[model samples]
Target: MNDLDKVESILFSQEKRFRLVDIPGAGRGLISTSLIQPGDIILRDKPVILGPGVAEDGTYCSGCGDISGSNLNLMENCSCGLRFCSVSCKQSWHTEEECRIVSSIPEPKPNQNYWLITLRGLVSEDPRIGFLQELTVQEGAGRSKEEDEVVKLLSSFGFKEKSILTVYRQLTANTFRRGRGRGLCAGVAMVNHSCSPNSRVWWDESGSLVLSARVKITPGDEITLTYCSPLLGQPSRRNKLLQSKGFICRCPRCQDGTELGTYMSSIRCTKCKPGLICPVGLDEDKLGWICSSCGFKPNPEKVSGLLKKVEDELYGLEKEKDPGRKLLLIQQYIEKNKKLFSSDHFLQLRAGDLMVGLMNKLAPSTSCIQTKEYYTRQTLKVLETLDPGLSRFKGFQLFKLYQILFEKIVHSAQGSLKAEEQFQLVQDMQTSLLESKFLLSGDRFAPPEIVENANLLVRALNQEQVEQIQDKINQKYKIVKSVYQCI
Candidate 1:
């Protein structure tokens, strides 16, 4: 066997389920031996590396891992018993409790326990703090040399007694959560670097984290997970991940404008038209574009300026008072540029999303035949290109489509539907909900209330339709659960 084959076998044999595989074009990546379907379990691992806990120090807030004290105290402890900078950050941690209790526990070493004791004693004396006393009693009973090293490490990182206690609490709680597992996973140890990754890392409901193929995987694919959520487009995604994770990703998707046939980085050719024609650049590697027809070239500054103007216009329209006027402007802009920019283009997609939002807002309440049919047609056209399983807007759009069709039936049939129409509507709603559930899975940004509402709607649908919706929800749930388990 070749070296890569040997490595792959070793990684996926009975001894191991995963390993880093070398790819020709891509860098080193993780791979799975077994065929993993849409929502199959992959791996459940933890962090092999961790950073210092600065939350409980009162010097740093646990909410966003930000050191800022303002509004930091408002954050509650996470399920893992650690504090985060905010509720959003806490949810991201996927832990059970704030690490306050863990922080109060004594270190399992001779001198180290002294700091733990100090923090615990202070917490105990405060009327507001009886929740962590249990942990204090547990830590006071035993000590270990390893605990000493950890404490010394924390001290070196400038952690005081309060923050040190918090760190200890976080560790202890995570350890307990691990049951019998060893240290964190090597995969999770690899820094998250890109959004449109060749690979994806996910967590399940049970808290296992798993790594899997976000796209197709070959024997030598380098696996990657976006540090930031994938919902954000390329520019914003890259900037945020780089700033927070401290790494600039050179992944194929990040480097090249083409992925899944979408030109994510194209800019309009200003010379061709005042605000319309976009000329595709020489792939994504060579800087600047050579116009296909005119041989005109745009400097980077010009391209950037064009993009800025478009963005500014979009922003201005977002605040416009008249939805109809906004929609008309957007439609005109889209129509003007349709030949130059395909629907898949990022700018065009944004425009389409705005149009969908406007349509939803302006649709007649009772069912105007013309408006209802018009929106249904528009929504279907968009869905042809957009993955209903990925876009949040897709679900709402589908919901609106169904609403329109229902309104049409009501208006024509005088508030009653033929058995066939009823069956068709049920089928459509079920399909839409199923797609939406998958799209919504593992989306931390989507409020739990919204999910619950969607689930309730699914439940109220026809019995035959229920199975399809449940299946989709379960499939996504499994994928998420496996990701958590692997984590």
Candidate 2:
């Protein structure tokens, strides 16, 4: 049997949520074998070979690379002085023959994870070596240059150049920045990238790669993951993908300048109402931008200059020392950019992010409770559009939203408010708390401070609030049961 076929068999044999299939327009991709729901961790895969990244140099779990203080033990180092979180992790890293060889090399240099992964893929007795051979590497323009340098490194490990190159391509394309460096997850890596992806990936508490459905996936749907940060605007996402992964994105979002009606790439037209701007189907190139209403085509050079100037101003505001002026400047910037980048635009979302930072600094003060809530709500909306369903970003936003509602109580004397206002506040608080809990449940990558603060907030809620939320949750369960029966 071919090496890749052998590896696929092992993967298929163990997989439960999804299976490998050749998609029509795409090549080999992960297809949902059964229904997958939002927030459900459909798959969890361990890394094939993991270590510190090119820039990272620290004692992380040799097993999971968790550096966030998970009670890691310094019992023993790999032969090369790498620390482990536990005995199990240490044992796991000290692999049969492959990792022993890795440890024997005393104190591997930075960026050696690539070599380590290639070596393990070649010589490891496991079938993952065969699977690693199957991943496609971008090999057109710059491939010729890297080929020679990589081959030299391969030769040092006493392996055939062909085998090494095959694994190298797969590793470069598929490896995630995990385990302190580079982590190769066999099943998770099988999912390809899409700008508007249906799946989102995260790290579980134990550091396993968890893939969750961001949207409903019925039988036989192709599962996809985003390679670049989806939070960035279209131009930025496209630029990053082209530079890093060596591919021009033709995703639906990329082809349309409006970016699914978000107007993220639109320009500010001073002549139009609200001075709105958009790209024109101008001159035959169709690449030129113009006002949506006024049809004002801008010089591309001037557009770039304007964007740079605004970004530079934002940077200055970010570094501003005075908190109150920083917030005022942030609000002023948002007011200006709302015309440039619509409220839903990623740049505006970034403005929301800055306001969240501002809100946090003034969270204890009663003077701006309403303002804090407004920015928190606005930021939550933006995150919903960009990074939807079971994201650390969403979790933090929800947690912040919860804090804003709870702060009304803290700010008030004896937690007093009008009767209707109290009910509305309670309902909003319940919704935010429930969502934040669901989003962050089992999320290991969530900041410890956020997690702890969220916990404290939930605990601070009185018995009456807890009871109201629980009753509503029970009612929801009953409704779901009834709907299921009817279906």
Candidate 3:
């Protein structure tokens, strides 16, 4: 059978909701065969061949590919000289037969780390590895120096040149990191990419990759996942895709210069108070920007320099490694650059997210609470346009907003507020809690602890228990009422 036919046969056996179909310009992609609702579990597939992802230092276990116990000097007893966490792992993952195969070959040199996964594919009798031949194999220009060494090593072991190249490229394109290791899932590998995807893939508690709907998808609609982070702006997203995935995204979001009205990459224009500067066209590398309200066009080099400087400063802050200091640095950063970019620019949005976690770590202040609330709302507004409808990002943000609101209400002086105003705050917090709970309920990426916390918070703040909850929080803080009166 042809590649498409073979892929179809494999996917059909696993999932009935979607079918493999040839897409123009996109090669092969999965399409929904029936209506799929937001948050529906679409596909769950275990990796066909699991192994350590590309690591040059050989720090991971050969059996389970975990790096945790590598530092404990665990590889000494292994027959094949590969790292294994325990005797069970050595016996189970690197069996005598596999050991014989590994021992026969010369030890690969430094920087030839990609050889490990390719060798695993070649020697294993797994039927799923054979299915990988039907997948696309990228080569030529982007092949790394290490991969060239891999090709020579496989040739010396007498594997065919064609088979070696196919598996090498397949592993490069399709492998998904599951915790400490990486694996290739045949069915999951076929799902294509989009900046604004209708679906997302997450590794479950059992280590299986689960694909779920992010929005309502009708029959015949193509299913996609963002190979890169959804939080990135257009230029960064496209550049990442081109460098890593070997294609430029022409998705709807990438095509629109305004990024579907979120203005994620736009800057505030200095020449016009009410105007924002946006790209004139959809070129991913274009540096020119045009003002929306005025006819002014900024120098491309000037804009690039300013953006680079801001990015460098943020990068420096990220390396701080101390949460308290990092929080302070980001506050200073936002204060410095808040007027340069639009409120919803990706940099601001990302910094806002970082601040959320940092604020939770340190003591809460009235100013911190208000800042957190503003950033949360701004981030939610952008996600509404980019991801929308039961996405994990939006759900997580909603949960955080609920937490911040709960803190605000708890720290407020109960006796000072009018009855109706107090009721409104409670109503808003409850709505956020309910929405977050619904959105994150079945999400594989949502931590069990987070879900449980949401449920517990809901029970704690139930309308009948509000007064008791307030009393408990007030007691826990043990601060004077006047300190909280500012909230």
Candidate 4:
């Protein structure tokens, strides 16, 4: 067999069950031999590459991936002596009975670590929660909760006290240190990384983590998803992965920024004449050129330093009760960074969203006013650039448009003509939402609060009107499915 075939054989023998093949210029990579549809179980191998430390502290859930506090709290250990987030999960575990065998394993010696046991054994348990068994085996004899740091961190993130303790006890019972799980499915682990990935990773109702291509992925494309938050740019991502994963990623996306010399080492010139030239500071390497017209070149360090300051100010603005103040801050950030960032930059897009949200909050009744009309147009422009019809932003902008039109119909002092115009606007907004496949797309990029907010908005809309909208949405979904089948 050839080298590629040899690699595939080794991986399959290791129980990864994925086949490696060449993708022309992309080199050798794993691909699904079976017809893997959206949200299908592509692979379920152990982690080929595990991080140095367990994600003891994070903004998200390690269990269910929920950012909301309403998620279940930790419960007592099940019959198998395994702890879960709640009684529901514990009961579910009971049916599997995988934990019984796992929990019964003898603990390791004082010097032995729990993660090591997992690495050593061939655990044939549920991949979703099977990692817990490794801990169970390692915790063999000794059982002591010596002030759990991970639990404390989770508690600080507003996780329920019981939930925090439960997860901690469970993790504590196993391994406290990090270790890699060999023989993990290459289709899952070998998937590449991207700052703007076309796919999203999600856990279905069955608790199995599934990957869905958010955008159209070519047949031979190396399927990838953003491991880190996309809201963060290059340097932040590198720092995080380095600190947590202990690997300096040489991924194309990461390398691209470094090669461009845009890894927090350059900024646009604010003083440059509108069309003449844009200047950037020259450091160890000449990052960019200086503008001749205004002789403008910003210090890269100074520009990078303002990022945190801008973020802090934005946070404060979000918390402010006065909508005008919030809007001002949003505009201030946008105008100040206009030269520093491109119009299509994610930060600018986010600021545009903030502006629309603040407008809605400030004057829901007058959002369609000529003064606010410009903002909506700007929002539409940004959302279109980001993903056009296949983005959560598109749904949000549509919702905003619906709100503006609805408010005008309800509160306007004008005659029935204005009401008619508003009605047409609402219809247009609904059509836009349906065309975008907003509901079927699933909420990945949007914050949990935003999803909740959208749900509430849907609930508040006129029942008959909503039913009509749902019908249209369903029709559009059918068409989209048909198109995908044809493709």
Candidate 5:
């Protein structure tokens, strides 16, 4: 059988809803054989080969591959110099035989985890290596200093240069970053990329890669994943795709200058305040933008310079430790960029995200609260357009909105609120909570507090304790409304 056929045989041995097929332009991709609903598990795969990515620095456990903060530097006492969380993991995955082999290396480096991982795959007689060999090599892009060091170290161990290069290339091309490291999952590696993808993949606590449908997939649809951040605009996304994945994405979102009507890449026109200047063509490398009104095109360098400045500011804001300082800088940034970028621009969305997070720490006036609400709602709207169904991003944003609504209800309860107004806010809170809970279900990437808070709120809503608060408020107002205000 062919390599893809072998991969299919290995994958189909497990429960899967998709089949591997070659498309015209996009080499090999997975196609759904059956209708797949959002949140449905498309595939659950364990890594055949697991190792550190470029510059990972041995932060993850060698055995069981757990990268949680608590597991770091746990047991560096192994003769092989591999890290392990416990004795059981050391015994289970990193065996005495493997340790002996690793220890026998002529001159091992401090962080030889990359070399060790490549060594395992190189020396192994496992049948899966045949399928792995079919993966693309990271060639012609020039190697990093780390990669060169890895090759030299492996060569010292007396392995063939050809075999070493082959294994190294396959690992680099096909691996997905689980945490501080990457893993080569044969089935998942075959699925191609899209800026807006139908499927999402995350590594579970058990070290298994869980691939689920982010949106509904009818039969014959190609299963795709985003290789880069979905929040990035076309230029950044395209640049990332080309540099890393070896292709420029012409995905539907990438082709559209307006970024699917969200104006994620568009800047507001200076000549006509109402108009947005957007890219004119499909060429990601070329600089061509035209305003929808007044036919004005700003200098490309000027646009790039502005974006770079804002990007640098955002980067600095992200690194700032103090929430208060971060909030101040973000407010300053919003005021500075308001005239330049459209309200729904990706940069603004990022700032909105930062601002939404700061809401928990700072006490704002009623106007500030309303502004936060506006940003939250706009962010949620943009996310819905970018990632439609069961998105982890949307789930977090929903939780933020839920927090805002909850706080608004509490604040209004202190004052005299119209029973109907209070009831609407409570309804919005429950909806956001429940929706977030459902979206965040089985998602390991979501923060623990978000999941916990969502569950708590859902339970409280179910018990109707907040409903009691609403009744008290309603009685005080003496209005015939089944008002549901949070206490």
Candidate 6:
């Protein structure tokens, strides 16, 4: 059988809701075999090989999996010269082939830090494991000098020439960071990257990788994953992918800098109201950025200087302890760099998010509350364009809006409101609470604290509902939230 047949057989060997399918130029990608609704768990697979992250932190016990400190320092090296947390850990990691491999290698040297995971992979290798041959590694992503050193080291052990490179190729294209090091999840590795994806992957309690549908996916639709964060606008994301992965994304989001009318990375044009400053499309353009409305192009130095000022101020604000001071600093940042940032750009969205958090902690004033509502609404509007439906980001945004709307209601009653305005505020709170609950009720990506807010919103809604079922609704929330360990 050919390569496709081998991959097909591997994919079908287990119970699966998806299949490997060919994409022109992009090689192969996973396509849903059945219609998948939003929040459906599509696949769960444990990593075939688990090892240390690329940048390994303080040492971990190979045998017991205990991290560095205390008794770990007291423990002696194994016969193979590998440190272990205890005798059992040493015994556990010292399998026959691993011991042979370890015993043959020279001592660790400075600047060979890159070989840590490679060493673990060699240690974990079983003769039964298969090298996935179909995935190609580009030249710059080709074998490293350290890798050649590893190959030379392993060659003395009678391993075949090019054996290490064959395995390394399978690893480079497939692995993702579990913590600091690469996790080779075979099922997850098959799903190719897209900036706007229908599905997402997360780790469940057991550490098995779980892929869930973020949007309703029709049968035969490709199951794509964002290899990098979609929270960033197109240019930052593209540059990151190119720097790390050696691929220029042609995903529709990358092709269009306007980013579905969100203007996610666009600077606001000083010349026009609600106008975007974007990269003028040319491979060798002198005036890098142009206003979308007036064609007012700013020189590269002007844009770069403004961005650096904002960056320095944002960094300084991170160290500010006083909420009032931070808020002042953030506003100053906005006033200082208004020309370089649009409200929709990732940097401003991030600032808005930080400001909202600060507002929550501050004494609730009319100005603070109003600012919270504005920023929360701005965040949700950006979410609609970027993440769209049933996402953790959207869920969190709705929760914030729900809180802000309820705050407005409390403040309205405290200061005395007209009956009509009071009635409308109550109606708006109920609507916001229900929207937040609907979006967040099934979100597995939400942390325990954020997930509990969904219950609190529902409980608040119960008070507004008829008194007859209020007890019943409260009891029901208690039961459901217990499953999430939040009650």
TM-score of every prediction relative to native: 0.50, 0.74, 0.78, 0.53, 0.81, 0.69
Choose 2 or 6, whichever is better by TM-score: 2
The CA lDDT at 113 in model 3 is 43
Over the stretch 6-86, how does candidate 1's per-residue lDDT look in tens digits?
544533344443565554443445555544443333545543222223213333333223333575466565443444555
Q: Pick the candidate with the highest TM-score.
A: 5
TM-score of 6: 0.69
Clash count for each candidate, listed in order shown: 53, 3, 0, 7, 0, 4
- Candidate 3: which stretches are off by over 4 Å? 52-118, 127-142, 145-168, 283-288, 299-302, 413-418, 431-434, 442-445, 455-487
For candidate 5, lDDT tens digit of each residue in 193-218? 88788888887777678888876789
Give the C-alpha miss distance for residue 419 in model 2, angstroms. Answer: 4.2
Tens digit per residue, CA lDDT, model 4, 6-124: 65554445443236666544344555444333333344333332211233332222112232234324434455433345555334323442353434444531211223122122222
Better of 5 and 6 by TM-score: 5
CA RMSD per model (angstroms): 13.1, 5.5, 8.3, 10.9, 6.9, 7.0
- As for model 5, its CA RMSD to the true structure in angstroms is 6.9
| lDDT digits (tens) for residues 91-142 of candidate 3 | 6556566677677776653332467678877877776666543333245564
Worst 10 residues of 4 by lDDT: 175-184
Please report, in order, the local distance difference test score of every candidate based on alpha carbons: 0.46, 0.64, 0.73, 0.44, 0.72, 0.64
Better of 4 and 5 by TM-score: 5
Q: Could you give candidate 6's per-residue lDDT for residues 1-487 as a string of tens digits?
A: 8876676676446777887878886777888889786667788867666544444556655533334556666775767666665665455445767666666676663322344445555556542135343344455565567568767766677766476666654555566655334566776777888888887776666756778777778898998887776667645575566545556667767656677778877888888887898754423422267788888888867875666576556778977998888988887776666666776677777777788898898778888888888878887787776774445566567667778877888777665678898887766665555555544554334435555654665565554363333334334333232222211
Clashing pairs in 5: none
Give me the overall lDDT of model 1.
Answer: 0.46
Task: Select the stronger candidate by TM-score from 2 and 5.
Answer: 5
How do these models rank on TM-score, best leading?
Answer: 5, 3, 2, 6, 4, 1
